[model samples]
Target: MKIEILGTGCSKCKRLEERTNEAVTELGLEAEVVKVEELDQIMEYGVFKTPGLVVDGEVKESGKVPTVKAIKQLLS
Candidate 1:
């Protein structure tokens, strides 16, 4: 699965990234996790807020940092 974390390197963004990775590890899914920092790329996903989560090209969450449990639920 293709998992992308969208952010401009903010604290919340970092937290999301870490939690996403933890979810991926716990799930044992062989997925690629990328950090999208470009404004154009983030806008392309129609997200105006930092710390966005994109899975398989679909925007899942944005604006707030999600907890590990929340991320695991999303990944599942």
Candidate 2:
């Protein structure tokens, strides 16, 4: 699975990235966690908010940082 964290390196973005990594580790899933810092690339996902989470090319969360448990659910 490809997990994309969309943001311009803000604190929330970093937190989301960390939570996503934790989620993937807890789930024991091999997913590529990429940070999409480029505005053009983030816009491609149609997410206007920072700290967006994309699972397998689909937007799963946005605007706010979700908990590790929530992220695990999203990954599931």
Candidate 3:
């Protein structure tokens, strides 16, 4: 699976990334996690929010940081 975290390196963005990593680790899934910092790239996903989560090219969450458990559910 591929997980993408969209943000411009803000605090919330970083937190989302960290939680995503924890989720993936706990799930024991082999996935690639990428940080999308470029505005154009982020806009391509149609997410106007800073913290967005995309799982397998589909936008799952946006605008806020989700907890590790929440992220695990999303990944699942």
Candidate 4:
């Protein structure tokens, strides 16, 4: 799975990245986690919000940060 964390390297974005890593680690899954900091790239996902989460090229979460447990559930 390709997980993309879309943000502008803000605190919330960093937290989302950390939580995403933790969730993936806990699941024992191998996935490439990418940080999309570029505005053009983020807009490509059609997300106007700062923090967004994409799984397998599909936007799963946007506009807000999700808890690790929630992210884990998404992973599952």
Candidate 5:
């Protein structure tokens, strides 16, 4: 699976990225976690907010940093 975290390197964005990595590791899934810092790439996801989570090319969350538990659920 492919997971994308879209943000401009803000605190929330970093948190989301860390949590996402933790979730993936806990699940023992081989996935690519990408941080989309480019404005154009983030806009392509149609997200007007920072800290967006995209899974399999689909936007999963936006505007807030999700907890590790929540991330695990999303990955699952």
Candidate 6:
């Protein structure tokens, strides 16, 4: 599985990245988690918000940081 966190390195974006790591660890799932910091790259996902989550090329969440449990649910 592949995951992407879209943001420009803001505080919330950093938190989301951390939570994503925790979620992946707790789930014992191997996923390539990446941060999309570039504006062009982020825009490609069609997310106007800084914080976004994408799983396997599909947008899952946006505009806010989700809890680790919530991310786990999304991953599942």
lDDT of each: 0.95, 0.95, 0.95, 0.94, 0.95, 0.95
Candidate 1 at 20: error in angstroms?
0.3
* After superposition, candidate 5 runs with Cα above 4 Å error: none
> What TM-score does candidate 1 reach?
0.97
Question: Is 4 or 5 the stronger prediction by TM-score?
Answer: 5
Q: Write the per-residue lDDT of candidate 1 for residues 50-75, one digit (tens) a residue.
A: 88999999999999998899999999
User: What does candidate 4's lDDT look like per residue over 24-59, in tens digits?
Assistant: 999999999999999999999899987999999999
| Model 4 lDDT-worst window of ten | 57-66
Off by over 4 Å in 1: none
TM-score of 3: 0.98
lDDT of 6 by residue, 1-76 (tens): 9999999999999999999999999999989999999999999989998799999999999999999999999999
Ranking 3 against 6 by TM-score, winner:
3
> Which lDDT value does model 3 have at 21?
95
Candidate 5 lDDT for residue 26: 93
**Could you tell me the C-alpha RMSD of candidate 1 in Å?**
0.5
**In each prediction, how many residue pairs overlap at the backbone (N, C-alpha, C within less than 3 A)?**
0, 0, 0, 0, 0, 0
Off by over 4 Å in 4: none
RMSD of each: 0.5, 0.5, 0.5, 0.6, 0.5, 0.5
The candidate, 4 or 6, that scores higher on TM-score is 6
lDDT by residue for model 5 (1-76), tens: 9999999999999999999999999999999999999999999999999899999999999999988999999888
What lDDT, from 0 to 1, does candidate 6 have?
Answer: 0.95
